[model samples]
Target: MQKNALKNIIYSIVLLLLVFLVYLYRKDQPITSDNPDSDVFKMVVSGQTMGTSYRIVYLDPSGRDFKQQIDSLLEVFNQSLSTYIPDSEISRFNKGDSLVYESKFFFPILAKSKEVYTNTDGAFDPTVGPLVNVWGFGPGGASLEDSVSIPDLLRQVGLEKVEFDSVQVRKNTPGIYLDFSAIAKGYGVDVVGRFLESKEIEHFLVEIGGELMAKGSNENGELWRVGISKPDEEGAANELFGIIALNAKGLATSGNYRNFYIVDGKKYSHTISPFTGYPVVHGLLGATVVADDCMTADAYATAMMVMGTEKSIALQKEVEGLEIFLIFSDENGMIKSYVSEGLKPYLSYAEQNKPSLDQ
Candidate 1:
């Protein structure tokens, strides 16, 4: 398959997104706070490992009612989207017909994913489960390296090779499966965002894993600022490669940081290419995308990773309203970066102050 064709396939399978809440620490000296809807202070119920934290800060005259509502919202979101629960819609679908059939819940996201797949020319595949498992990244423990042969693996993988009817989805070849891990978190974020909005949360921030969506503003009226990870080093973040005013927008980042392996003397990325049946070896270390929906941003970031730096730039030009930030290594081994033009609208003051490598 051509590079573009391969990317489109992986793009479809790479839709799963994961979120963790991490930790929340309030100011040592209670920062001046304001009251809006209800005076409900921020509280984190779980750890980041729980994946994605949904917080609601409201002006609640009666703290009891607000707390109850927040808890109810969180429960609803978990019930609907949690893969950890075997009874959840996603979990059931993933374990049942999703193996060789399509369920009702799968169609909604599948339909939405079609546009992203077509636009990226198959760079983003949501049906890359089989490959993910063979590479030892699936739900099961890592597969023996020798058990998977790359050439043989390629024959069984391909987005086009998978057939999906309205009622069922099946692979052309046996043993191929689907995994939406890449886009799941994004979907989860959207779910939580909607739930909060239903509670009349006009302004708030929601983050799952690294996927996030921010809107409205703190009572003080400052836009929510987010920091993007610097892929050069683990646990490093740049002040602000971009910022969304929470004028109501979302951000999702896909990178080769958390999951990867070293083979021989080279490092292999976890974002595997369905076309080659091999982990992406490109110098493009990470890509962050901003869009109205966190799911789209999440999947698109992975697609861009396979597109690499050059193709990603060209593709960005063709797609409007899509912003991308790529961290890549040049020939000399130095890490370099690029940002799509659309991203300029969200550039934070600090990002603007930083030297523009593109120029």
Candidate 2:
């Protein structure tokens, strides 16, 4: 009888071990559906970075939380690109330290800035930092209208004043400053999106400030939808001018409607013209651009804001795979918009406001 009991105990131990192994296997396995038996889930992570809030939504089959990893990635990006950090790589470059070869983040953005600068004929120049400061839109909030000369500032406002390659960047002019504020947010979105893709996450949306990138379908298995805000004053009620369905694309918008100042009955927009060294005064209130990447969309949106409506429309025709939606005022102060042929199928106007559409 004692021998029989010993054999039974051994059999129980082996069964328990087998059960534990099965549990471990199931825990590591990924489920691809939202059914009760499946583990696939939608995860949302949000935080503040680059002086603005960011939100990331992704469908994870493993049901893992990635908030901590996402935060770390954004912190590293800011250390390389954020001017507000004062000791960041870009800040150091602005403060006369020209050689920044250590950062993995700096070179890619620098290269993109050069491309846009050349393509836009200096309209998308990052070397316009001095003009941005004097216009009270930069970190230096005080407008130096009384002490600074526009012509003197214009000398320091061109990408040709800076030279850079993949390894190192050198400033040709001592006073030249590089500010990637216009494109950095979009690049931030791209950075987070790439991180998700690296982890084998197929469906995701990454948004920083107003710039965003979308890939694959959303939680409901439909194309991701985004809204463009109406061009209104800073204190006015926030509303959407239109909605767009984005499919593996990036979208960014630039407008002076919210961030402008009136001095002596003249409105000064925050978007400074690189060539003129002055805030652009034009009827174009907003420019929205969509591209394959958020960084390209962001830079082109800013360039379009400076280029005005007609020039921007012409540019859209010249560049392939670029879709633009331009909002401007007519001679009688009526709001009118021009939507590129590619964007018309994906765009729809809001109920209360429908401006005359021009293709």
Which structure among the candidates has the greatest lDDT?
2
lDDT of each: 0.60, 0.78
Number of clashes in model 1? 45
Mind giving the per-residue lDDT tens digits that candidate 2 earns over 224-332? Answer: 8787666665422236677778889998888777656555666667789998988888889888899999999999999999999999999989987899988888778
The per-residue C-alpha lDDT of model 2 at residue 278 equals 85
lDDT of 1 by residue, 161-262 (tens): 655656655446665545566776676667667766776666566676677777766545566656654454334243343333444777787877545554
In candidate 2 the C-alpha lDDT for residue 5 amounts to 32
On a 0 to 1 TM-score scale, where does candidate 2 land against the true structure?
A: 0.87
lDDT measured at residue 165 in model 2 versus the true structure, 0 to 100: 84
lDDT of 2 at 264: 60
TM-score of each: 0.76, 0.87
RMSD of 1: 6.9
